[model samples]
Target: MKYNMLLIIFPLVMVGCSFSTSTESLTDEIITPDIEKIEDVGSEMITHHHMYDNMDRGNHDYVDKTLVIDPNESEIFRGDVVFFINEDGEKDLSRVVALPNETIKISNSQIFINDKKLDTFYGKAHRVGLDKDSYFKMMDKEGNDYDKEVMKKVFDYNLKEKKLAENEYYVISDDWLRGNMKVLNRETVIGKVIGYTK
Candidate 1:
């Protein structure tokens, strides 16, 4: 009986010692955050939005699985992540390009966030007049000289059409090479993308 008791006690003591050693080792080691790893995590999380300007017609949605932003929030702090969905109900990741009362327009082959060309590397390429003029002529409904070449551009503005109120904003895809557009209002917006899948 005593031998069995000692056997059990020996194991208990050994376990206790092992736990102590593990604890000490953990305390002695320093744990640091990896910036590169964090960036990789952010990329996997779909925190940023994406738009295509060159070929794909901007209909392909890259599904993201993080963040849902509220448009009515009184104060939007920095580092807030947001997302936009493709009009075809496809999921693509996008950051909030404009806040409330901001106007997004496409004139040249670039995007103007609040009347200024936003300096961004979010698009694949720049195809001028990809489909802008055709979309304009189609939306005009007045037969305002929609050209045949313009019809080849296959994107229509896919964001929201609702008027932006005092504190509301709008966003658009970067595929408006030829003037075709899709608008995004705050209400229609999906949550801001906080992460993306690889």
Candidate 2:
């Protein structure tokens, strides 16, 4: 009877020792995983990340204010933020275009800088009649009269009556690669594109 008890006790002691050794090894491997989990949780607490800390610094708040801009002007500037919607309406980006008192005009699908053609590598085809004066009366190749309905209410002041006011500039889309006929005054400009963030 004593021998049987000894046999059972011996096996139990060996099994207990084995379990302790396995537990110690598991703890050693688990410590690193636990620390990694803590680090992940800490990162999640951040509200946002600073993205512009390493970017180039420059004046990015230029605005053109020569003309009366319509809210539906397809552009908007609220405080330090500017908004521009893509033609397809799929994306909207914040940016400023012109500085105050800068004159701008688009002609022949080309943008003229200070009456001289600009060699900008950016922008799209210029739309005609964006700044046509009241004297501008013509027909398209198809003989359709120049459509002036859209600008009728937007541009209440005619060019003949009032030239670009002081401290004003015109802003247009860069998509006007060739320069759209539309002109924007610095006063009417929303803002320029500085950077983008998600």
Candidate 3:
């Protein structure tokens, strides 16, 4: 009787182990492919020119960089680097500064939203105009010293308060000195930058 009982228990234990291993293998196979499919469908890798370089000045000279874009992003928030089609039928990227139906203005080299100072690290650092020496150099380079008054306007550049439409957003390049500001409709925005590849 003892020998018979041992034989039965050994086979039962072996079968249990085999069943557990098979189950784990099946689960891994199902989960791994699903995760891969999600990644492939949810994000895309694209080469983008780093034209809006407000966060860093060194990358302003039109360097082509790889960016991971999430095209399904539905909610766009302030400070998000977004990809959109410009008025000229070109793909472009900019940082969102004002949301829908909000008033935005650049006054005295500062950004104000709804009569309040924009409270972001980049908001305070928005470069507006060149310094006196740099401005003079630019004037000389262009061979137009007579436009000194016109060039001095860069030092205290200001934009009148403009209210956005219900589906419009105020976007600007990271380098404010470039003076690239546009009101983008919601439909024009394609995606937001999720990450970068070196």
Candidate 4:
């Protein structure tokens, strides 16, 4: 009777172990891809080839870097690098400098948001002051003689205060000297650049 009981109990335990192993493997198989799919949604990898410099050094060279974009973001914050459609109906990228309904002004190569000076690193970093050589070169290119007053005006040019609409954003490239500031509507924004491949 004891041998018969041992045989029944041992088989039952073995069966339980085998069933658990199979269930674990099945669960892994079913859940792993779902997690991967969830992670992949709204994320895309693209090779950026534009000369936009809002997210990089101010060099206006051709780019072939791969950037990871996340289109799932619903809220856009200042200083976020975003991909969007420009007013010219072209895809472009820029950094958000001012949000909706805010007043933005570029005064003497400085940024003012809501009448307050934007005390940020990018705001300070991208302001390229004109050296004498660069100023002379610019004047030469324009077929004009170099003048200190003209050079100062180049650096001191200001954008008049503009208040954005509720669905508008003021975006600028990192190379503030050469980048154009554009007011984009919310519908034109495609996504936020989340990462890049070095």
For every model shown, what is its TM-score relative to the native structure? 0.35, 0.28, 0.60, 0.60
By summed lDDT, the worst window of 10 consecutive residues in model 4 runs over 26-35
- Report the C-alpha displacement of residue 130, candidate 3, in angstroms: 10
lDDT of each structure?
A: 0.40, 0.31, 0.63, 0.63
- The predicted structure with the larger lDDT, 1 or 3, is 3
Model 4 bad stretches (over 4 Å): 1-55, 58-62, 124-154
- In Å, residue 75's CA in model 1 sits off its true spot by 7.0
Encode model 2's per-residue lDDT on 31-91: one tens digit a residue.
1101011212222131122222111111121122111112334333311122333345422
Which residues of candidate 2, in runs, are more than 4 Å off? 1-103, 123-163, 177-192
Q: Could you tell me which 10 consecutive residues in candidate 1 have the lowest summed lDDT?
A: 25-34
Q: Cα RMSD (Å) per model?
A: 24.1, 30.3, 22.7, 23.2
User: How many Å off is the CA of 35 in candidate 2?
Assistant: 38
Candidate 2 lDDT: 0.31
| Model 1 spans > 4 angstroms off | 1-81, 84-95, 122-163, 174-180
- lDDT per residue (tens digit) for residues 73-169 in model 3: 7999887778878888988777788899998888765677776676554453333234446657766898964655654564466899999999999
Comparing 1 and 4 by lDDT, which wins?
4
lDDT string for model 4 (1-198, tens) is 999999999999998887653221101111110001123423245434454444445232223445556787899988777888777888788778889999887877667787677766445324233343665676678897545574466457688999999999988766555565789889988887765543
